[model samples]
Target: MSIWEFANPRKFTALSLKILPTLVGLSAVLVLGGLIWGFAFTPNADKFESTVKIIYVHVPSALMAINGWLMMLVCSLIWLVRRHHVSALAARAAAPVGVVMTVIALFTGAVWGQPMWGTWWVWDPRLTSFLILFLFYLGYMALWAAIEDTETAADLTSILCLVGSVFALLSRYAVNFWNQGLHQGTSIPVATGGRTVADVYFLPLVVAMAGFFVLFVALVLARTVTLIRERRLAVLDAQEARA
Candidate 1:
């Protein structure tokens, strides 16, 4: 079946209910395991020492912040084109989570940067554009809140999301565009020309990234289910009032 079939509240709710417990359980296990491995077992970096461990949280959170926005963009597009209520609700449900992830990334990055970069803040292209992304998220949410009519809010937010896509792209590619900052060049362990971070350190970073992805998925699914239920209730209440 097409992806849209799953957008039905009843179908979505049933699927969510079936998967929720498993998702929650796995998320808790993975996050805790990842933290234990990252903090206790991972060796300190020769350059940054234990401070580098922050990568476990900072990198994954930053990546998820971007992924969450992309998901919202897709949902917004679907809502605008199909006038699907669930699509709009999913987009709304994703906004706060995206914002929270962005905040975590920025906060953790600042903490990690202080000892390494000697400053907690910078006007570098990547950092500055990420800040702008946070602002866009806030504005999008506020626009939705300010409007009483759901349809109008969806349309306006969709437009804002599309516009904000440019900034998101800039945020990702800022380092390449500007060629500035103390941020180290990208390298993956086991890849050609990769940084030779110790395996003790590398494993935990991988686990942490997996854990965060699980947590993000669980949050989105739970929030979408809640939004679907609330919308269903509202529709029922409206019909009763009409009767």
Candidate 2:
């Protein structure tokens, strides 16, 4: 069957419930297991020392923060073009998760930077763009919360998400665009087929990254299901009142 069949709320809910437990279990295993291995087993980098271990959280979170916005952008476009309620709700559900990821990334970056950069924060190109993306996530969620009309909220948030996508793109690419920034390059380079980091750090980091992505999917799926149910309950209440 076509993937779009999931656009139906009942089908989406059914599939989500069926897979959520597995996703949750897998995420916990990977995240917790990878982090423990990285912190306890991996050797400290000669340059950053023990502080480099924070990459397990910081890198994955930063990647997800950018990716989460891109996901919302895609969902928003789907809602705008297809007028699918599930798509809109999915975007709404993702905003909070995105914001939390942004916050974690920023906080961990600050903690990691203090010793390396000799400062907690800097207005570097990548950093600045990421901060802006964080603000956009806040605005997207605020726009949703402030509006009473669901369709209106969805429409306006979709526009906001579309506009905010520029920052998301910048957040991901700003390091490459502006090489002068203090932020280091990617640990794993896709195009180069080579990684800057060592094998010990690379394996755990990969596991952590996979864990973060799976965790993000689980959170968004759970949240979207709740939103769909809540919307259904609201409709039922309206119908009962009318009767």
Candidate 3:
């Protein structure tokens, strides 16, 4: 079947049930393995010492935060243009996950910064924009809760999400655009001759990123299924009430 076929609530629910278990299992395995390797196997950084271990979680979560917002933006666009209920539901499902990821990124960053930058927090460009992204997540979710009508809520929230897209983009490139902080440039990139982290450390970082992506997908799928069922039940209850 084509991709659009799964847009149906029943079809999506059935597919999610079949796939969620496998995703959950893999996510658990990879995350555990990554943590062990990152913390125990990798040698301490010459400068940052063992505290560099935080990169395993912090970097992945930061990447997810931006990607999650992008996912919501795309889903919101589809919802508005195609009037797809599933798209709107998916966007709603992703918001909480995105918010949590942002929190993880911010918390882990602060912990890492304490030793590296000699401060827990700073009003730097990248950090400041990331905080704004988190607030955007909160605002989007709150808007949905405040509006009683689902369609109206989706429409309004979609507009806000689109408008807030700049924050996500800015969060990533902020360091490049403005040099207002001590945050180092990309460590994984070769173009800048960044630090050549050992494979033992880098491998776990890869696994952790994969695990988080799978986990995010599983959560979004589970939440979307619940949303679809609730929406259906609401329609049925409304019909019965009218009758």
Candidate 4:
């Protein structure tokens, strides 16, 4: 089958339906195990102590917050280049999930920061950029809702996503160029070389991050399927009205 064939709403919806159960079930297991290990089983850190436990949820949410926008950027590019309706709707479906992830990151950061940074919030580059990322998600969703025409809404939001992605990348890499803030430098590296976090904590953190990824995928699949159904209903309603 062609790439565009998968872009069909009905086809994509059917595919998402078949895969969602595994995604949901496995993610739930991983998240439960990670939480159990991170909070209850693992020994307290030598430095941060019990407070370090927050990293389990915080790091995973932060990772997803950045990646979710990147996923939307890719979907927006696909929609812009190939005019794929499924891609557009998928991007839309992922927006609120991204928002929730961003919120969790910010909230957890504040919780972790109070004892570490001595403040609930700061003007740190990383923190500020994350706030901007949250705003971008809101604006993207608002633009989509305000426009009545799906195609036109998709077009405008795709442009917004392409533009907002520049800032999102900046948020991720800001610490490298700019002054490192009260926020700790990178703790987790994907390849597991030159690691900062201990293996015990890192391992569960990895599992938690993987669970978050799977959870995001499940949400996007279910939400995109809903959007596709709504689109079909709108089309049929239009046809019946004309008939």
Evaluated at residue 76, the lDDT of candidate 2 is 97
Model 1 lDDT-worst window of ten: 184-193
C-alpha positional error of residue 211 in candidate 1 after TM-score superposition, expressed in Å? 1.2
Can you rank all candidates by TM-score, best first?
2, 4, 3, 1
Off by over 4 Å in 2: none
lDDT of 2 by residue, 84-202 (tens): 89999999999999999999999999998999999999999999999999999999999999999999999999999999999999888888878878998886888987878889999
- Against the reference, the lDDT scores of all candidates come to 0.86, 0.94, 0.90, 0.90
Error of 2 at 90 (Å): 0.6
User: In order, how many clashes per candidate?
Assistant: 0, 0, 0, 0
Order candidates by lDDT, high to low: 2, 3, 4, 1
Which 10 consecutive residues of model 4 have the lowest summed lDDT?
Answer: 183-192
lDDT-superior candidate, 1 or 2: 2
Candidate that scores best on TM-score: 2
TM-score of each: 0.93, 0.98, 0.94, 0.96
lDDT of 3 by residue, 1-243 (tens): 688888788888999999999999998988887787788888988888899899989988998999999999999999999888899999999999999999999999998898788899998888988999999999999999999989999999999999888999998887776877877666777467565777767889999888889889989999999999998998999999999
- Residue 65 displacement (Å), model 2: 0.6
| Superposition error at 166 for model 4 (Å) | 1.7
